[model samples]
Target: MKAAIIGAGPAGLAAAEVLSEAGVAVTVLDRMPSPARKLLMAGRGGLNLTHTEPLDLFLSRYGAARARLEPAVRAFPPEAIRTWCGGLGQETFAGSSGRVFPRAMKAAPLLRAWLARLGERKVTLLSRHAWAGWDAAGGLLFNRPDPEPLVLRPDATLLALGGASWPRLGSDGGWAPLLAARGVALAPFAPANSGILIPWSAHLRDRFAGTPLKRIALSFGGRTVRGEAVITAAGLEGGAVYALSAAIRDAVAAEGEAVVTLDLRPDMTADEVARRVAAPRRGQSLSNHLRRHLALPPAVIGLLREGEAPPETAIKGLKLRVTGVAGLERAISSAGGIRLEELDEHYAFRRLPGVFAAGEMLDWEAPTGGHLLTACFATGRAAARGMLRAMVG
Candidate 1:
């Protein structure tokens, strides 16, 4: 049997591996000149493969889509991902944050090894082939630089085109209208794992545009995440802010803005902060007092002063108004795609037979630190299995 996968990303490539191993001739096509550009870029700061947290806690990171992705994740969980990496001669290690990474800590090595293995299995990779819906004869149409588009007719096809984020790296959500025209249900794409836009004062924007607020905790919508964030010229970005992005984004959509409280000293209690703030200033400026007593950095002090709260209360709960989220071009991933209800358990479109989808193309969002990649790999494998079953039956 021949199978065509219209994407060369983690999901499409993962599916290709599964189908090829099952004796299916798989052809992996991509719009980019090379495959897995986003994966390589993401690895610049250590390629996080998966998380080692307990299964339940890990699954909860997916939020509303937990139930839909549970089966695939359970079947090909973090351990399996590690095993797969090892099979490619890339050993894996878990960091202090419970995030997994290849021993090389770079995606290029892992991707290179993966592609070599796929090549050995006779999986064909056609670059610069952008899927453009279907031809008159129901064949897959791919637009190329040439005048005529390329056409393919495989026994089954998997649409792993990613959501509309990082368009430069190949997942521009261009496939949305194509599927929507076919009468498939879809949710409008939105930013996921994106930074929050805060209108910083001219002083803060000019002086601390790139400053890092380290060892801070951010709270929004009753949830708190402890990590670090950087002050951008226009807003805040980084791990801590990204964890609460979805809540903040939705709140902003409904209320025009969202307030996020930053705990400058997460390790200390409110009373401890108050006590420190009450300590004698000894003629030192308030910034010096905060620096000496609370150990808050300059950026944190600037941020605290931006709010109307006094130093004592602001030290523990300095609120910042988030007016918007970073656009899809800057988002780490995207939320909302083909709605989950449009796909059956097999990952195949209920209305478009023999055509399946996996990865970010589905309407699910998760925080950083490995949740995104894990689901992509898991669902890709699951979709391949479903396609195989469909072919047999």
Candidate 2:
């Protein structure tokens, strides 16, 4: 059987591996000149493949989509991902944060090994082939630099076009219109794991922009995440801010703005902070006092003084108003795609049989630290298995 997988990303390539191993002739197409551009970009800062957290806690990261994605994740979990990486001759290690990364800490090596393996399996990879809906004859259409679009009719197809984030890296949500025209149900795409926009004072914006706020805790909507965030000219971005981004985004949508409380010294209690700040200043400036007594950095001190809260309250919980979230172009990933209800248990579209989808194109969102990548790999494998079953039956 011949299978065509669109989007040469983590999901599409993963599905190609599964189908080719099952003796299916798989052809993977991508709009970009090369495959896995986003993956390589993610590798710039240690490629996090998966998380080693307990299964229940890890699954809870998906939030509303947990039930829908649990099966695939359970079948092929983090351990499996590590094993697959090892098979490619890339040993894996878990960081202190429980995030897994290849020993080389770069995606290029893993991807190179993976592509070589796929090539050995006879999987055909066609680059610069952008999917352009379908023809009246029910054949897939792809646009190229040439005048005429390329058309193909594979026995089965998997659409793994990623979500509408990092468009420059190839996932531009261009496929949304194509699927919607076919009467497929879709959810509006929104930014996920994105930075929050805060109206920083001119002083902070000019002086502290690009400063890193390390060892901090951010709390919003009853959720607290301990990590580090970097101060941008417009607002904050980093793992800590990203963890609470979804909740903050939803709150901003419901309300005019969302308030995130930042704990500058997360290791200390409210009383401890109050006691430290109450220490005799001895004519030292407040900033110097904070620096000397509380060990707070200049950025944190600036943030604390930005709000109207008292020193004690500010140290324990300084509230910042989040005006909005970064757009898809700046987001690490995207939320909302083909809603899960449109697909059956097999990941195949109920209305468009033989055409399956997996990856960020699905209506689910998760934080950073490997949940996103792990789900992409899991769903791709699951969708491939479903396609194989459909072909047999």
Candidate 3:
């Protein structure tokens, strides 16, 4: 079988790895100058390949998409990822947070080795090939952003274009429109694992802008995330904020604004906080007292001051305004893409036979913590398996 895999991110490359190993001659076409721009970007932060945790707990991270994606995940879970990294000569270790990393602790070295392996496997790569939808008579077409066109045909095709985030590095969610044009049902792409845009007060912005809220807990709806948040010039952007981004995004879209609560001190109890605040202080400034008693970072202080002083009763539960979510271009990942209903168990589009989709291109959003890459790799392999199954008969 011959395979043409599009977008050389984790999913596309994973598909190429699986199909080629299955004796399928594969050609991976990418719009980027090189493969895995997002993967390379991820590696900059120590290349968290997957998480080191039990299967069930880890699989639950996908939330609503869990059942639909379970089989693939079970087949290619985090342990499999660590094993694969070992095969690539990058030894792995689990972080204190349970996120796995390469011993090299860098994405570049691992990627360079992975690319070398892909080359050893004889995967033909065509870089700078912008996919221009399909040509008449049903074949692949390419537009190099020039006058001429490039065309290719294979026994099967897999489209692993990433979500709309990071358009500058490609995966511009442009594939959504193209696939929709080809009669594929697509979910509206919304930013996920992204920061929420808030109306920061001028004083707050000036004082705490670019500050980090350390050891903080953010609450929205009924859930709480314990991590650090960074106060950006525009608003708040950080891991904890991103963990709640999907809920916040939908809430703001539905209600125009969402109120999120930040537990300025998640580790301590409100009673503990209040008790500390009640302590006698001789001519100490409020900032110094708060700083001394609670150790609240300047960012948390600014956050607390965003609204009227919480009555001492409300000091522990302070609300922050999230006006909107960061734009897709600024998001870390996206929430919406090809709806799962459009694909069968094998991840092949029901409407377009011989065409498979995987990775963030599919309509699923997971928090960071290696769940994103796990699904991408799993779906890529699943799509390849689907194509292989179809060809065998």
Error of 3 at 3 (Å): 0.8
Model 3 per-residue lDDT tens digits across residues 1-393: 799999999999899888988888999999889889988888787877789888999989999999999999999989989999899888999988999899987888887887787888899998989898999978899877568888888888999989999888787988777888978888888898998888888888777778887787889989999898898878889989988999999999999999988777778888898898888778997767777887765556657777555534345778777889889888988888999999999888899978888999989999988989889999999998999998787
TM-scores for every predicted model? 0.98, 0.98, 0.96
Task: Please identify model 2 stretches exceeding 4 Å from their true place.
Answer: none
* Sort order, TM-score high to low: 2, 1, 3
Worst 10 residues of 3 by lDDT: 307-316
RMSD of 3: 1.5
Residue-level lDDT tens digits of model 1 in 1-393 = 999999999999999999999999999999999999999998997999999999999999998899999999999999999999999999999999999999998999999999999999999999999999999999999998889899999999999999999999999999988998999999999999999999889999999999998899999999999999999997999999999999999999999998999888999998988888999999999999989998877888888878878865887888888899999999999999999999999999999989999999999999998999999999999999998998878
Instruction: Give the whole-model CA lDDT for all candidates, comma-separated.
Output: 0.94, 0.93, 0.86
For candidate 2, lDDT tens digit of each residue in 1-393?
999999899999999999999999999999899999999999998999999999999999999999999999999999999999999999999999999999999999999999999999999999999998889999999998789999989989999999999999999998998889889989999999999999999999999999999899999989899999999998999999999899899899999898999888999888888888889999998889999988988888889877778654688889888999999999999998899999988899999978999999999999999999999999999999998998878
